[model samples]
Every structure is written in structure tokens, then in C-alpha cells.
Target: MMSNSKEIYESITTKTIVAEINLSCNDEQIDSISLTSEDLQNTIRIEAESSNSTNESYCSNIIEESEYKPDVPTEFVPVVNSVFKSLNLAVKMYNDYAEMSDYKVKKFFELHNHPLESIEERPYTKKARKMSYFEKEFVVHASKAKMGPTMAHKIRAVLKGGYEYVRVKVTDYKNLRRGVNIILCYKDAQIMINKMNDRRDHYPNYSFEFLRDGDMLAVMFWADEREKAFYAEFREVISFDVTFRTNKYKMVFVLFTTVDHHKKSVTVGAGLLSRETTESYEWLINAFLSAHKGKAPKVILTDQDPTIKQAVESVLPNSRHRLCMWHIMRKLQANVTDDLLKNKDFKKRFNKLVWNMHIKPDEFEKKWELIINEFNLEDKRWFNDMFELHDKWIHAYFSDTRMSALMKTTSRSESMNSFFNTYSQFGNLLLHFMMNYDTSIQKQRNTQKELDHLTKKAIYKFISPRPIEKTCCKSLYKYIVL
Candidate 1:
């Protein structure tokens, strides 16, 4: 009975009307009545198969029964699918309506609101024209208010309820602050960023700071973690080298260190140099020390710059200053005559003499003495200086497998120097240096990521081909899927 009633009420196909009747007179209610001027005497009947209830109750019954679906399925799809599709449509329509409402509200405020100048309010678009005559006819007030049909204003006015309402709330921002973003647009930033990376100013957390101790200012930089946990896991390893700028007395200070693969891309400390001096280096070192107080490095790698060397040993007493082997080698090559340096046997023997990692210090010293005599470098200025640090160089520190490989040479440090030069040529100011900072680090990271990928690929290809292939696939999937 409920289903029947639902089906009946669901089928509403009439131009409905209701009339009051004399209920006790036994008069019948009409079901299908046709009114015509010619048939004025046509009698009406209730035509009910079962009708004991009141006339209104009977009509209500029919409406309630109309809720059910019909027995016959539509040609299109099942009722369940149709219901789902309808639900989806309803949600979409609701979202669209909400968006439209927001747009209208915003426009209404713009046209009718804001900017507190009291007078006769003039709408942005007063004289408006419509594309169709019906629209013009339907929208009589808008046409009167619009001065000219600026499409933008017209779109706003029409979508936004109207122009009068919109003119009410338009306003200028108060207490707004603005700052200069030199890499103004995305494309420009990209190019400059790329250029900085090429120069190895490093990327991600780039910083350019000028620390002044007296008159000299050092441009400091570090692309380390944002929280700057300058924990020198072992200790501080400072690698310093000087590269010239195109502008004279304008030195681009590129400072960095050697860390584990994971720690390679952090800027623990950095600064710029105007007049590279002891005081200037001292100030920069002090700033780094202040920030990373007890975490001073155990070793600092740098060339034989007297001022920088002195500053490091003085301030960071715990740090063991090691001269960059490359720099030492350069000095060795420079000091020795061309004939002596060109000795192929001497070059090979010297490298063997320096890299005595596995051997004891006494054994290394014994071999070093052999090379000294063979090359006649006993009295040579570079040979003695290079040999002067030999005791510290091949100590128990050099024999330690962990320290030896990482501290073997300043090649990685040189790579960092190359990085700084790649970035510094572009800008002289601090901000300019900072802007290129992250880009340099990102480049290093990207290179490392590539190397990692290649290494994984090679390893997988050789060890377990199928699993490696799957691993490679997973990486690729993640990249492209995102």
C-alpha cells in the first residue's frame, strides 16, 4: 500500500487546483473534469473505487504514494546509476553556485563599496549595453546606472547583483609593507639562479652577510640547514681559498668544508671579503664561532695565507690547521725549477711519498726522506714547508682509515671554490649573493642525486638485475607519478 501510494504521488501530471465542497450533501468530487462554455450542465462524480475518507485525505494519499519508482526501468540505465549521476550533478551544481555567489559578492563590493570619499557615488560602469534585447528589457535598472559598457565592469556589475551594491565596500589596503625582490619574475629568477649555481654559490639556504670587525667587512655565507645545526660531527674542518673578483679590492670570499655525503650540502658558515685581511678573516671566524660555539672543527684546510692561518689557530685553538695539499703542490711546482718539476720519476715518487695512509708515520717519514734526497728538495722552500707539516699530516690522524680518505686531499674543497666563483661574478651586493645561494646548493644536490641514481643502476645491473630494475622502476614511477 505504501509503495502504491509512493508510485501514485510520484506521478504528478496535472494543472492542479482545489475547490471547497458541501461535504454532507453526498456530492461527489471530480477526478477528470473538462470545463467548456458549451457544457455548463455537466455533472461531476468522485469516480472512487474505494473512498470512505475525506476528500482532502484522498488527495494527500495520492501525493504520498508518488514517492516510489515505477516497475519499468528507463532505457538509459538502472535507477541506482541514475540516482548516483543525479547526486554527482547536484554536488557540481552546488559547488558552481557557491563559486558564483563568491564572485558576485566580491564584484558587488568592488562596484558599490569601499574608498571613503563622500559624495554622489559614481559606479565604475554606469552606461551599460546588452547583447540581446530581452536582457536589456529584463535588466532595466542596470542600463540606466551604467555610464559605458566596460566589459570588465559590466561582467562584475552583472555577476555581482548590481553596480550600486558593489560601490559600497571597495578599499585600499592599510598598513601594507613592500620589499624588493630583485629576481622579480619566475623566468628571471630561474636564469640568475642557474648562473649562481654554475658559480657554486650553492643553493637552498643561501646567505650573504657582511661582518665588520674594524673597517674591513667580510661577506659571510652558508647554505646550511635553516636551523643551522653546525654540528661538526667530528669537529670543524675549515677549507679557505682566495679567488679574485673583477672589481679590484673586491674579493669574493668562497669558504667551505668537507663533510660526509649526507652533510655535503649545508652552509655552516660563510662571509664576503672587501680587503682580505687578518682582522677581516678574524671577524668572520668569530661570527661562525659565536653561532656554533663549542662545535669548532678539529681540522681546518686552507692555503698558506699567513693572516687567515694565524687567525684560525688563534681563535680556534682546538682546530688542527692543515695546508691544502693542492695549494702546497702548487707552491711546490712554483718553487721548484721547471727541470726539477718536470722529472716524471720525481712526480710519481712524491705522490707515493704523500699517500702513505696505510703505513706507520715512521715508515712514511723514512720514504719521505728518500724522496727528498732523490729530488734534491732538502733546501727547497716549498719542499721544507710541505715537509714541515708532514709530522702532523702522517700522524695517527692520517693513519685512521676514516679520517684519511676524507682528509686525503682538498680536491673536494677546490670543487667548492669552483662553485663560489660560478656564483660571485654576477653580483657585488649581499642580497645579490644571497639570491644565488640556494641555487648553488640545489645544483650540488642534483648532481649528487644523479650520481646516486647512476650508482644504484650500475650496482643493480650487476648484482641483482631484476630487483634493481624494479627499484629503478619505483624511483621513476614516483618521479613521473607526482
Candidate 2:
């Protein structure tokens, strides 16, 4: 009975204390104090208990699965195999952990430190070495000595020193030769200039000009006495066109050409211009005229380039300018449809409109409009532009000039380009290119001599055996048989 009475007294005292704490929390007088309430204290205690429970659970799991081993049957032989595997696995795990730790430490240090330069593996592997000055000099000497063999043969001859100092493959040798050519281009030009002056002294009629832009050869014009004599005879009509990428300097190769009496292309003068501009054309044309003693041709045919046209108009006002009909016709396929190009009737009609010298200008205009409208090509911009320039190229307008069938197109210049390509290639040193040009010219002159001999000896039979034809043939010079 006493113990029960004491328990009740203690329980009543505990309830009264909890009630007093609740009353203090709810009272407005204690709102300004910095003490935490019972709710907040309870939340803090719950969070602490959850955190400790999580740590205990994690520790238990880690210890329980710290090192797992596969089960083995007791009846199996070599029971020590399992033990050995576990020991090896433990060693591997230790090694992995050590490697990871080491990697992390190194990464941390790398992040804080300046980076080192990255070195390439096998830096010199499969790369071409730079050619020495002696090797390059030998290449030049060999080329001159052998009279310009292919790059492969040139390499073989150059590496005859047994591949010790010159350890270059064929391709590497070619690249090195190009570099050497570029290096010696200016010197080669100087040598060519000296040679030209020497020729001029020996043959007083030889004319040449040397033009330069800084260290590069800009424009070089040369006409030998034989070339000048040919120009004097065939100066009635001339054509010039620009060819490119035929020398080390990659200069423009401009050829002034004419047609011989036998309808053969003959080169009159040649130039290497660094640029293709109105100024360059102007200078080239002026040089050509000066070389021929200011005798401008009656008709000059060229590709329909606007810069060249403008230069011609400014420099050769007395000369009639005609765009190459062949050049203009080549663009038809690109500008017109395949169906139209395949139509034989359309091609025939187009050729008639372009080539028939009997067609009047008014008739040509009517025919051109009818053809365009019939072909539904009225909206084709290139065709329209070409139609606008018909007077410059059409045969009807060309009738008024004394072109004399000497040149209907710049095909003579194109032939000259094709002929030069047989001997010269792109990136030949400037001097070497000029020397090749001389050789080509000499060959052409030799052919001309052979043709002259043929004409003098061979009697051409007339296609129509008429009395007047025989008389005319008898009266004509052997060179004019064509």
C-alpha cells in the first residue's frame, strides 16, 4: 500500500512539470527569449537517432560482405585450389586499391601543377627529311646534265652517292625538287636574262624584256630574230591566249600566235606574266607591237575575257577584236539542256546561225530569237548574255573586217599551248622553262623548214581540173598552194 501511494505521487508530480513546460511555451511573455521549443528539440533528437542507425547498418553490411568466397563441395579434390583463388583475389584487390590511390594522388598533383609538353611518339617516323644545300645543288646540276629526266630518274642519279647524305624516297625527292626549284627560280630568271642579252648582242634584231615584282619574275617577253621575221610576214592576223601553272612561279603563259599559209599554227611571241589583269595585257600587247616595229595586226582574236577585251580596246584601237567562236560555243552545253544538245536539228540550226557568213544581221536576230523561243530558252541567262554579244562574234558582223580567214577563233593560240605542253610542265624552274621554250621553238622552225622544202618540191594537184585553176596555180608562189 505504501509503494502504490509513492508511485502515484511521483506520476502526479511528472504530469504537473510537463504541464508547466507546455504553459511556458504557449505564453506570449517568453516569445523574445533565444531558447528552442520542445518541438524543435524532439526533431533534433529524431535526426540524430536516424543518422546513428544508418551508420550502424552500413558498418554491419561492410563487415559482413568484406571478402566473399565461392562455395566448394567437400567431396571435390584439390580443396587447396579454393584457398589459393581467395588468396590471389585478395592480392588483386589490394593491388587495384593501391593503383586507384596512386592514380588519384597523381591526378590531384597534376591538377595543381602546370602541364608538361606532350611529346609525339616516333616523331621522325615516315617523315621526309629536309634536303641539304649540297643535295639540292647536285639535283640542279644533274637535271642540267641529263637534260631534264623525270623526277624518279633525277632522284636515282642524285642519290648515286649511296643514300647516306641523301636519304629521300621518290615522293620526298620530288617534293624537295619543287622546293629547290622555287628557291632557284629568281636566279634562273637572271641567268635567262643574261642569255637573252647575249643573244641580242649576237643577233642584233632579237628583242626581249625582263619585268620583275620584288623577288619574283613578273613578265618576260622574248622574240628571236626568226620569230620577228615570221611575225612580219604573218602580221595580218594574230591571236593570243593565257595559259597557267606551267612554270615554277606559276606565271601566266601568254602566247601570241598566227596561222601560216598552210593553215598551220605558228608562234610569234611568248610571255610569262605573273598576273592576268588589264595592266598586264596592256603591257604585253604594247611589247608585242614594239617588237614588230609598231605594226599592229588588222584583226586580233582572243578568248572572251573582259579584262583582255578592255585592254585590247584601249591599246589596239585600230585592230578589230573578235572573240573565239569555238570558246563561246563550248559553253552551250553547260548553259543549255542535254535534250537540246542531243538534237541534231537544233545543233545544225545553231551552227548555221553562228557560222553562215551569208546571213544578214537582221536575219540573224530573227533566227536567234526564233531558235531561243522555239527551244524555250528565253529565260536562260547565259544564252541571253551570249545573244547580246553576237555582233562581236557572229560571222555577219565579221564580214566588214579584213580578217581574211586568217583566224576565225583563237585555236592557233590553243594549238601553241598544246604544243608547249609536250615539253614544259608546271613548276619547272623559270630558266629551265625558258630553255624548253627555245627547244620547242627550234623544233617548230625545223618543221616549218621541212614544210617549206616540201612545198618547193611537191606540186599540189588541183581538186577541180579547170584551165583557170591551172593558171592560178601556176601564177601562185609554192608557199601559197593552200
List clash counts for every candidate, in order.
54, 0
Q: Per-residue lDDT for 184-226 in model 1, tens only?
A: 3224324433554544465444433344446443344333543
| Candidate 1 residue runs with Cα over 4 Å from true position | 1-210, 213-236, 246-251, 262-266, 337-339, 374-377, 392-397, 446-482
lDDT of each: 0.48, 0.66
lDDT of 2 by residue, 339-426 (tens): 8899999999998888886788999999999999998998999989988888777878777665445577887788889888777777
Q: Tell me the spans in candidate 2 whose CA falls farther than 4 Å from its real position.
A: 1-186, 400-406, 460-475, 478-482
TM-score of 2: 0.60
TM-score of 1: 0.47
TM-score per candidate, chains pooled: 0.47, 0.60
lDDT for model 1, on a 0 to 1 scale? 0.48
